[model samples]
Target: MPPSLKPHLNGWYRSLKATSRSGLRVERATNQPLAALRGALGVAIALFGALALSGPAMATSAALGAQMAGMATFQRSYRPRPWLALATALGLAVSTFVGYVASPWPALFLCVVALWSFGAGLAWVGGQTAGILASMTVAVMLVVVSLTESVSQAAQHAGVIAAGGVIQALLVLVWPVNRWGAHREALAEACASMADYARRLRHDPFAPFDPDPLMAAREAAVVTPGQARSRPAELTGVRPLVERMRPAMSALADPRVGAAEEGPERDRARELLAAAADILDMAAHTIRSGVSPKIPERAYAALALPDDGPILHGIARHTALRLIGLLAEVHDALETPPDDDSPRYLPRPGVRELLPLTVVAIRRNWTWRSAVLRHAVRVAVVVTLAEGIGMALPYGHGYWAAMTAMMVMRPDFSQTYSRGVARLAGTVVGVGVASAVMVAARPAPWVCGALAVVAVGGAYLTMRAGYMALSTLVTVYVVFLLSMDGLTLSRTAAERVGMTLLGGLLAFAAYAVWPTWQTVRLPHRLADQISAAGQYAAATLEAFASPGPVTRRAMRDALLDYRAARAALRAADDSAATEPVRHRGLRPSQLSDARAAVAAIGRTSMLIEAHAPTATAPSPGAAAFAGVVRDQLTIAAVAARTGTKVDLTPVRDAYQLWSDSADGTPDEILRDASILTEAVTGLEESLN
Candidate 1:
């Protein structure tokens, strides 16, 4: 082995020692993750039982209304919050009441929900869906069969479900886990290490940043607690897989990670992120085909940790597994080729990242004025139309339609259409199943229990995938649970189906009429990514031209800004939020045009220091500096396509001084380093 390579390779690995965030109190003492997940499961099951007993529409309505009320607010960024007293009453009402109606002051929620969505509304929606849907089919005993046959049953069911959810929230609170800095540190360390791999690929002049590793690394970097908008208390009860990553969130200070990355290694590292960028192009195709075989192994390979081989005990393993499972499901779908009418399930990628950072992410990524007004207007319009329709009809089912409309509205466009369809289908299926079971068996206590189990199972299934089929199942199960007590299974199913159809049609129609404009021009947006890469390359040149103090700070700030910008670009690329809007006005293709630009930038940055010319008390001038930067970028571009660039510059740093000159190495290197140092420090700000 070459002497330099050994330390180069081991350098990153050695930095994995667990470290504390010097001077932090209440240092996020977290309980075991599996324990918390199990506890949440238990609570979700208990609520499912209560909701199934809701016999009539009113009972289900009021309960659902109350639960919806609590759903509107949260206390923390992550889920599984301490149980709030409000949650109990809300759950009980929603689960037990059938035909129970609560007039939602649309104006209030319209504004609030719009903001909430801009915050953590999307993640909260998924969590609540999981939590509330699991509580389905139990209202037969909890509200419907046991109580007066009135619409109030809806409120009762909602109350019990909310209660259970609240309990689950409390469990998350005191059960012990660092909700703040320590946890963030751990996540940061993991990301930095992953970034190192990307940096390596970015700099390898010989090898273009392998899209596989870059894609994998970027995908891994998806979630940061900063993205979630809701209170931590509200987010705690939903997707539990993310909670596992909390421990490593505090390990951000590990300097070894993303540091050793240079030259070819740096190029490789950037490619890892680039691959993630390519997913946007591949996503629709992948989803439609239901096969993601294109996902490269490098994406998974670099993420494997030495501690337990990456996919073992850590949260990354679980997330990776989730990806594999999703791929398998997509593969199965393609192979089987299900009909449009048949059950279809697709994974909701990136929710784990969004779960905790919901609000901050929204504030950072989206235009607040547009998000609030667009969402609020859409929701309000949909509600008013539904109410108008109800008032015109003989029945008072307008409330149901109104409620469904509210539930389906969203600021995130990716799943909005899917949600509407799912709601419509599930309501039909669930109501039909409930009505059928009621007619056949009179929905005795045992039958109710059986249905309750089905709801829990359905909820569990839904948790696994965000596909419409699972949504259908949840819809069926919840309606069945509510109608169990009413003893009118078939009719209830039909009504739910109708109500869901009404809501789905209204929400989407409203959205289509006047939706929030896409954030940026797709072509320009994609092009900007290349521009950013260019800037990143230029910054690298500055770093190369500088000495210790200047280089360190320049590299640090440049990478920080670059990382944030790159992340936004990638999210637009791979996340469902951006892909479906492929309209004639803006063709959102895989940004191949900018691909070369970014690759050149990432790779050049990695190689600039390597290519910098060095001499004892060397000259300091624009010509010498430009030669290094110019040569590095050109070589980085060439190496990306041709394989690697030759770094022929002689090393004149202290390490070289000690070995070759045997004199005051640090002093000697510093004495001659002024030119490079000043060049880098002065020029570093151009990219920003």
Candidate 2:
């Protein structure tokens, strides 16, 4: 090839890569833009109608519709009922009424108390909707208090807000979207994501692994299933399977496993993975179609290995064995259905059960060392201080200060900083646009009402896109909200900007005074993850040895516990990564080791979850070796908990025994056991 042609080709390739990466993000955003838009439009219409009927005196009602639009934070699986809307309305009414009845000092004290209590309640509830409701409710009350100093006015505002909620509820009922359908969609997307990963592995076994698609799917699946008795069992059952497949998929995609020279074995492994991807694709189809696919006979027979091979070749071969096991698990997962007798997703708790559960949640997370508790305290301090300052300043909007404080401050340093920046930038743009509109158009009350509805729609549509977009839309929303009362438009924009800046500064200052750095939390998070993984490993092994109802239940519980622990660790790690250079305590190498250790254990658990070759009879020596591997895993976990290094002689000894077993076991069990032993050793080394 000509030199000039080569340069142009390489440049073209780089451009293509960049374009494709950007395109992927844009595609994901636009994928369901329509549904999001439709939901937004519904809220907008409700708000518009409410404003048209009640005029400026009842403008707060439109805020309810805006809240509902944003509050679609409920789990994807459960259909939100009108009762939730009413519940929100009740909460908002209480916040407004309480704020109005109290003077500044009393209000500050009450606000502090309320923030703490609500934070505890949210911790107990542990759902998306609960957090959203808690935050938004407190924010709206602060806004109301700033807008109206008298109890009578506050009461009127609260009443109208409740009416808006009813209107939003009616809209939801009139054109209901099925939460179960959304669950199915999320699950199907997860399966497709996994399948895509598998396909990539098959084509370029050395390709860089990206877990984002699957992670996003898992996050989306966090919603509780609906209360309806008719909810599909598959909806709840697919979560665990998808999670179990993640590590196995990562194992196959490891570039080290694909570094060997191309040969028959490598070619065969690729074909098997291709076949696995097909099966996963079919499983996704079953999820979507609600029709079971016939489990085909073993697509490829377990490979026969020579007595020995090159180290890399051996590694590649072992990966193939693991992949085969995972494929079988997927196949069986599709063939079998969730238990027929399994109850519908736990019905939404009744009003009677809500407080008790909230109490339980608070108790569970009420420690002085708890991140949630600390965050609650920070919020109380920041908000109360902001409100006091706003009240003292004639030009300040007290509610704006309180609202920004509530919205921006977070438990983690990174999130708090990011939210503060986004909120400030968004406010600047939003206020500027709103100020321009008010000054230039000076529209009638009815036109402002319509614009308010549009703003609500805009807020909903861009909510997930980013904070900047959400902040802009919300600012526009606030503008229209204030216009209804015919407030002085001339200085409104300037005052809002000042208040927002004040609130943002307060949030940052509060955090600086009492920060909860992720690095400080890393030890506990990593320990929890290791402990959970250990429990899961033990339960999985026990279930393999004795496949009984009790063992299965224990395994399932442990799996869920492990998943939660891992999530916590990841969250902390991400926050730590975002810390400024001066604030970082842990080195990149140490963090990498921690991650690798976790992944190693995860792969071990997945291998064990494939049932440990129960059909094959193992020799006594092999059985003992398996026990040693289990013991070593426990030892590694204990060391992780204690934050120490430990000797791995037991694991090394077991590996030697397994390598010299008297009677040959099936390659599947042998390879599985071998992988488990390696994981135990890897974990020990990582911890060291």
Candidate 3:
């Protein structure tokens, strides 16, 4: 066997293993009983309302609308549920009407499918919720349009579907269940994460903490004007304080900067950390429950510090004092009265303002290098090909093949292949189970509708339990919904399974022909992260060199950008891990060391931020040193991406100049600069 062929075979083997593992794993079930019940209620109303008013045929359309809309509510988004339902319903109605109009001309309909699928793929720029709902529009078009014969019939079907979605949205408005639950949970989780981080730092001073919770909380904080006005007081000001506390705690515990590794100062730092963990836990509980926290006696005693002045001196003492003040601020913020009208820190863009942003986002992602664009092209090509092939086949439900292809394919190699396998397996099992039940029971049309409602409700409840479970239930729901039209159970099941297999295989083949391998993009992702981290570090140093509002704001903004870049790189790495391709620009060991080096840069920056100087005069040579660090890291980032070597001679010379000219600089600033210099050196070594 040729060596080239061996690598391809090995890649396929690894891909298969990853696909099996992810496709079959069941996630831990979250308790969302009220949310599940509310969604089920919407399905019930849509299903039974159409059955009573119209007939079994129209009931299918209404049920489809409610089920899709209901599924949107379960997405991990903070948007209002009513709006989500309305948007989904509107998309379904438009898609259904277009599909009906074009069905008479097969060639025209295929073109329409291609265009619609492309748009759906591009909708990912808006977010996961938008993308999934957009894709469902395509699926609804393929499935529901078959029931209509004429343009007027199509309008009626579309209206009823819109009404079903309206029913769900109306229920969300009138029969609200735990309003702002997602936001509260997100904020609470962020606080709880910090609490956990504080505890970890008690053991390991430099323990790494995942910033995902804080990122999620920030997402949750973006609310509409009305939501902002009504948001709980505790949730308003606590996040910023929580964000500041993390860096303060980290700096206070670092032996090189604050407390000695083994001394009375270290003991005091541990005590302070323990108290902080307790306070943060209390804060999380208060935010989540809207109740005042019960501070522990030990925590109170620890927070009191020493009555006869603090035991620690210099920066260590200052950091401890600052931490206590921030904690007090957090406590006061949580205790804010309900009538308090503090302005929101995050922007609250209404629908009218958001539309332009969405348009700009779509326009920006229209480039060839964008993953979304690539995915869109893949979808258009595969769906059109699948539709053409399905039409040529002996099966009656040709659209099922196209629908399967649309559902299984994603932008990334791992998800597309894994979901393809999972969808096929789930469809087979779902079809078989539903068929057995229908064959044995010989249920009436009403019974079929009832069973379909139950299946949809089960799907909603098990959404977090992995795609396989949800797919199985959704397939069962679809089968039962179709059965209401008196379709034969055995034939329907056989056709569904066969069409699903054809679609899955077509999708897999299409992706294999034109895949966007994440492994190849890892270097670019790492380069972006390194650049962002350098900017963040530079911003922090600038703030230290000249303490003012402008520099502070820049520091904050840079930190956020750094966090986002880091998250993106981590996602790329995870996706690359599941791919079968060989490493491209950076080898595994080089990538690992590079990540550690970047992390060190971020940690050092946080330490500087933790001890921001308040002197009126600028620190000598600090601004120049900041520029040097930024320039060096920028070069290193380019080297990472271009597979070139990074030189650190200029960086060493700049560090030496800064050190020699630090006669008037604060001792804390000098110490932090030294740490930053070492971090940059580490980065140079990792890159070269």
TM-score winner: 3
Q: Evaluate model 3: give its TM-score.
A: 0.98
What lDDT score belongs to each candidate, Candidate 1 first?
0.40, 0.63, 0.87
- Stretches off by above 4 angstroms in model 2 are 1-55, 61-70, 73-84, 103-128, 147-153, 177-181, 200-269, 282-357, 581-586, 611-643, 650-671
Error of 3 at 16 (Å): 1.2
Compared with the true structure, what per-residue lDDT tens digits does model 1 show for residues 1-688? 9996776455323321110111011222333344334343443444444445533343343333333223322222222233332443343443333223322444443343233223223233334443232222222222232234344443444455455455545544455444332223333333333334323433441343222333232332333333333212211211121211111111111112221234433333343334432322233334223243364565454433334433232222332344334333433433343333322121123545545665564454445444444564566566556655644555433345655665566654544555565556556655665566566777654455456445544443333344344455556556544543454444455555666677677876776677553434333344444344435544544443444455445554554455555655565554323322333432233244334345444443443323322332222332244344444434333333232323414212322333344333333223223333332322221111
**Each prediction's TM-score against the native?**
0.49, 0.77, 0.98
Q: Write the per-residue lDDT of candidate 2 for residues 495-597, one digit (tens) a residue.
A: 8888889998888787767877776677667767766766776666555455567766787687767778877788787766665322233345765786676
**What is candidate 3's CA lDDT for residue 430?**
96
Which candidate, 2 or 3, has the higher lDDT? 3
Question: Residue 81 error for model 2, in Å?
Answer: 5.9
Q: Per TM-score, what order, best first?
A: 3, 2, 1
List residue ranges in candidate 1 displaced over 4 A. 1-162, 170-373, 387-392, 412-414, 445-450, 516-520, 527-531, 549-554, 573-591, 609-688
Query: Candidate 2 has what TM-score?
Result: 0.77
Model 3: per-residue Cα lDDT at residue 565: 92
Cα lDDT of model 3 by residue, 500-598, tens digit: 899999999988889888888889999998999889988988886788999999999999999999999999999888888877678999999999999
